[model samples]
Target chain A: MYVAAKGGEKAIRNAHALLAKRRRGNKNLPSISLAQIAQQLTLAVDRVMAEGSLYDVELAALAVKQARGDLIEAIFLIRAFRTTLPRFGYAQALDTSEMLVRRRVSATYKDLPGGQLLGPTFDYTHRLLDTSLGVADEAGEVDDEARQADPADAAPVAMPRVTDLLGQEGLIEAAPADEGAEPFDITRAPVSFPVDRSTRLQTLARGDEGYLLALGYSTQRGYARSHPFVGEIRFGDVEVIFEAPELGFELSLGTVQVTECQSVNQFKGSATTPPQFTRGYGLVFGQCERKALSMALVERALRWKELGEEPGAPAQDEEFVLSHCDNVQATGFVEHLKLPHYVDFQAELDLVRRMRAEQAAERPADGIKEAAE
Target chain B: MALMARAEAGELEAVLAGFAPLPAASDLKPPEVGLVMLRGRTGGDGAPFNLGEATVSRAAVRLEGGASGFAYRLGRDVKAARAAAILDALWQDEARRAEVDAALAPVRARLAAEAAQVRAETAATKVDFFTLVRGED
Candidate 1:
């Protein structure tokens, strides 16, 4: 005899308990602290903050630990939490030229003003596993000279950028500024056709990392190849400002670490406009430079509208890329088809039955004609 | 703090009290109502195709509070119109703001409690594991 299933709520509760027990693994062991993860797994924290669109490093670390290192799940958690937070105010537009330089480099020039500072990068390191690091513990020992260094010695010094040099020589086109222009907010409002540059960059910043990476790689493989050279990549902290209603002028709110990228691309002028060099801009929260640089190159490719260039490739088509870029919406729609749809199935069945009966009646007449022949 | 404005309770009551004598939907002469056919496109820039007709109702009213309210309801509802007019008066009257906030207290509390519950349940599942090595000679 068949029995209908019941106790769904109870079953879910029991399953949750089992999952909690499994995650706890050996209760006798010491518990990991949020501080340790924030310090040791800094790169993972950076990725979480970048995708989550949250500036708080500590909160990102907590989400990572809670999600058990599933970056996407952590991002979902952060987004959900962020939605509940009320809109307090808007921050003042940051000036990238005034950024306190930590790590700055340029590919267009071999050497420039305020010489290259390759601070704490793994670019030149060999990809080899070190066996000694597994059991090494040098926690308490500290060098006296390094510890006694003056606090002023560690302060960031302002460095001149390479792109400014090009701007001075008139080699690169002057940066355009529309101070009175309104910027669209992608989070609060739905995306419409012919989006502005700010909204496009916002979408790309929160876009799926893997999807953007593949799209970027396709360009390199000659899909919509635009010759791009890294003008400059800088990482450091910049002050955020917000204007108070009572106060006429803007005031400093706080500071946030950011990575900014500028890419120079070759553009032959159109019939009406003179030929000049163009540029692409990318800015992301936290210490993520490579992704930011890739984003800048892709952004330039998408700027076919303002640049008056022909839309000949995937990168040039704005609607096609932005519409299909979001992972959350894609995952939901794809997965939701698995839910029950008995009524829809019944309607399809009725249509099929009526069509088959008509076909069956015509089959005998066709057979009789063939026999007569 | 500068943006905050004070709203009192008695002023809200007066606004709500004035709305009780408005003409009912059935009593007022029925205005012209019709259905407009909406066209749907196959794709974003594809050819246009006929979808279906949607019923829309619109009404204009002058309140005793010296403010006119214009409403467009998706479906035909006489009671909804009367209620909407009352709401429009309360919205236009700055003095009724405090009373409106007081009326919404219960709903806001419920939503906040529900959000807190969800946060607590999610936080409870978070677990961290670590390994410690003991030194012995």
Candidate 2:
């Protein structure tokens, strides 16, 4: 006597309890620690940070452990936790030109300033999995190369931006001069249509990496057209400067590592702006070179209107791009179907059942009689 | 103010290294750690992306005289943060300004010493690489 009409509250509670128990998993097996997740599953933590839209490593690692390494679930958890916290203030835009670069390479130029130091990249590594990674050996763990400052090339206070060089040669349109206008804070308010440039960038930065990557890939398939070259990509630490109201001065809070990418795209002359190379840009926290590059491509793709060109591609659609970019939002709505939908289901069920009965009563022997006629 | 917090943050542990005179505070916000998404832009004005999360602790307090102060510091030091909020509130008062400065003197001395030590180490390792004059020149 299974009643489809009734709820599964008891079962649901039990399932949740079971989930908690299994998340901790077998007692005999060693339990994974938060620090280990932070250390070993660094990239996974990075994803959670990106999609979760919050940046605490410990908490993101904890979410990873808590969600049993389901990255989307962990991202959801971080987002849920993030909503409860208070925002202090916005940080000043970091100067990536002065980054203490750990890894820097330019596809456009070979012998650029700071030369190419390909620090800690997967580009050179073989794809084969090493079984030795399963075994934990503290001594065998690879350490990050200690950065040496060679006097032959001291890092310039301001590295010559590749785009700036193009601008100087009159090969590209000059960048918009700084108006010191504050960008809209999307976190504090609902995202409005025709959002400011900063708000748009903010949305794309934390957009689902996979989704953005696919969209960026689509551009290469001629969904959108852009002749893009990797002007520069850099990874490194940069100091954070915050202006304190109490002291009436600014101070360096500390440093955080970042990854940045710039894509130079071919452009023809528009009505107002001259024919110069357009720029696509991406910046992210941590070593996310691929994500940054994808973001840059997609960002440029979205900039068709600003460049006075028509935005006809799917990647170019602002509403479509922004709304579905957040992984947490996508997961929540889709996966909420797992929750009890008995009420809605019953409503549809009743309508179907009544319609079937009415049709049976109106017809003679069957639908066969009507068909024969 | 972020600058005040940075200036006081290093000294926070040291300033309250001893006893702190607690100003009357109703915690508008109690000491709590929250995740702040750090964003960076390519070439300063380029596209922005999340760098990662830093653990930040913050506290806000209003003194008896009604000056309100707030502090945000790196990491999960609750007591230090609470003390900083009170110091911020106290330092605002003309009468308490001198007292707050006196209390923070040790923190300043220690930080200055640390900076000097770093400078010395950096100078010790300094190497000047000069291009060799070409034989043609």
Candidate 1 residue A278 Cα shift, in angstroms, is 1.3
User: Distance from true position, residue B88, model 1, in Å?
Assistant: 42
lDDT of 1 by residue, A133-193 (tens): 5667454354534433243433334556665687677666655554444456576678887
Model 1 DockQ reads 0.01
Candidate 1 local lDDT, residue A296: 74
Candidate with top lDDT is: 2
Proportion of native contacts in model 2? 0.17
Q: What tens-digit string does per-residue lDDT give for candidate 1 at B10-99?
A: 332444455455433231223323222222111111122222122223334555534544333322342344344444444555776576
| Superposed model 1: Cα runs more than 4 Å off | A1-7, A137-156, A246-249, A337-373, B1-137
Error of 2 at A255 (Å): 2.2
Residue-level lDDT tens digits of model 2 in A1-373: 1124556789989999999999988989999998999988888887787777665677889999999999989988988887776655566678887776666777887655545556556876798877776676553553322333443344243566677677778887655555666556667679879775667778887788899999999887887778789888887767776554545666555566677888889888777767778888877767778888988888888878877766688988888998999898898888877766777888889999999989888875878776888
Mind giving the per-residue lDDT tens digits that candidate 2 earns over B1-137? 33344454456655644435454588876688764446565445544433444566777888775698777665556676777887777777788788778877766676555444433332233333335688975
> What range of 10 consecutive residues in model 1 chain A has the weakest lDDT sum?
A147-156
Count of steric clashes across candidates, in order: 0, 7
